[model samples]
Target: MRSERRHVLVTGASGTLGAEICRRVAGTGWDVTLVVRTRDARAAETARECQELGAQTTVVAADLADPGSAEFVVEHARATIPTPMAGLVHCAAHFTFARVGRLADDLHSDYLRSFDVNTHALLRLIDQCGRHMVDDGRIVALSSVNSVLGLPGSGAYAASKAAAEALIRTASRELGHRGITCNTVQLGLVDTPAAAAVTDAGVRDLYAMQSAVGRTGRAEDVAAQVSYLLSEQAGWMTGQTVRLDGGFQCR
Candidate 1:
């Protein structure tokens, strides 16, 4: 185990998957920063969960998509710890459904907006903290399996996530020279609030069966893989995507 007590920051802390990441890392005795939107009750829940897992948590309330919120988020959290951002996990996301024909110029901009939350905000946060990144500091974003298997009405969401992964790959190359590792985890269908958006029961059933494990993914399952990627044991790994879908996309 490393001597330095790491401080990990996770955005989208109000969501199921994001909260799970906090819980898993906290259990390992890391300091956690749970970034959430102001006045969100889920934020309290996440904070409570983190504390239960035995980690000190800093609750940061900010709109990650607001202009310049990225740097602000990083700075506020950094002020809480002296460790120079030992880890960053961006689980924040936005999803909009519209077919290409219905995607007007304004609607098309939604794709960019998704990127703003899921990709650009992450990029800016990394840029602000990358230089001071602790040795082997880990940066992992929660991408989606949809990035590879595009959904018709969710193309914008998928494209944004894919772009975010591309950015991470590039960042891994740049940051590796500075002793920071960057990677992404593309999650499959998980039983989270987000899954409620899918109205097609047949599609959901099909996805559950498609997984070799014969079930939908869980936040804990994804968080377990995330914990490994953030560990000292994973120092050699970077610029990769770990799929946490019960071997759904298997060989």
Candidate 2:
């Protein structure tokens, strides 16, 4: 038998944005299943924080790049949580800096790796989780503005994100009859360790100056949006990519 509480499975729970999403949803009364590539200190801390927020939390380790990991993750969550999944938040992404024209044999591997994690894993997770989701289930995937803007030297990452958005849209249509809503949040520059790793100070400054908000995004900003998308209030919204950039694309 499943628990009466709503449960959500979150991917990439060790990262900044993912952790924030877990905390926000937990605070809003959702039990959490955190999927991490490793059950490290960071992942443990995230789970601990959620539990403190009054959520029943579980941590599972799975490298999404492995084809079998998605099935394993969904199964584990179901077994441990003993609840019908109310939502799925996919935040796992593989990124590398390589220009489309300059990608050599080794670089090509990174390109494929991006799709393996960002696109293929997402497809599998949606499929696996959808099987167990309640009728009003929510699915939210994190995308990048680069998916639409086509940032230079990020061809592989951009393409993979674009593919993810497409998958979400398709899933929304196919799953609509079941009252499941699927959507993607196209994000701008969020000030996170992952963002800092891939960009320099100069690049970050340029993005801030370009945005209408005159600053980069925060993890809380993304978390708030994810929480909303997962809420019953957003039942009518589906098959759309909501741009959460701070007006960065307006210019």
Candidate 3:
């Protein structure tokens, strides 16, 4: 077992999927710097859990929507963590349900916000954090199947995620010479608080039915995949968008 502790920066660290990733990485001897929009109780709890798992934890509150937040997060992590950052996971996302042509007045702002948080922030983090990473570094972003499927009522969200995937692909190519791997995980209907807020129980059941696995995704599923991508064994994998949708896209 690899026991050397490496440092990692995880955005959206207070969200369900982000928190799960933090726990999984921490258990595998990775110290974590959690970048949250607010240093709330939930963020504190996540840091505590990682520390209990014997991982050094730092919580830096920065809203990714801000153009400069990415630089601030990297600098803060560099100052706090003793080790050079080995991995960066961009888990923070902005999602809004706006159908094209239906909400013309609101769609423009929504689209801008989505791209700002999802696409631009990921790019900025890759630029800021990527500079601080060691050789064989890993960069993973949590994307959505909507990026490809273009699900109805998710125009803004889908477009932003698609753009993020493209940026990851480019980053992978540009950073490959340094042994840095950049990838995205296109997720399906995961049972998360964010999902619950936007979808109803009926919608959830329908997603479960559509999935080939006959169930929705779990946070553990995402965390497991993230752990693998961050591992030294995955050094050769880059510029790929691996789907973790429980075969939902197959149907």
Q: In model 2, where do residues sit more than 4 Å from their true spots? A: 1-4, 104-107, 249-251
Question: Scored by CA lDDT, what does every candidate get?
Answer: 0.82, 0.92, 0.92
Task: Between candidates 1 and 2, name the one with more favorable lDDT.
Answer: 2
Give TM-scores for every candidate, taking all chains together and pairing residue i with residue i.
Answer: 0.93, 0.96, 0.96
Tens digits of lDDT, candidate 1, 75-133: 88878766557898888898888776666566677766787888788888888768566
Clashes of 1: 0
Q: Across residues 1-251, which tens digit of lDDT does each residue of candidate 2 receive?
A: 12356999999999999999999999987999999989999889889999998888899999899999989999889899876688999998999998887665666888988999999999999999999999989999999999988878889999999999999999999999999999999999999999999999998998889888899999999999999999888999999999998888443
Candidate 3 residue-wise lDDT at 25: 95
Residue lDDT tens for model 3, 1-251 = 25678999999999999999999999998999999999899999999999999999999999899999999999999899897798999999999898888546655887888999999999999999878899888999999999888878999899899999999999999999999999999999999989999989998898888888999999999999999999988989999999998878443
Worst 10 residues of 3 by lDDT: 102-111
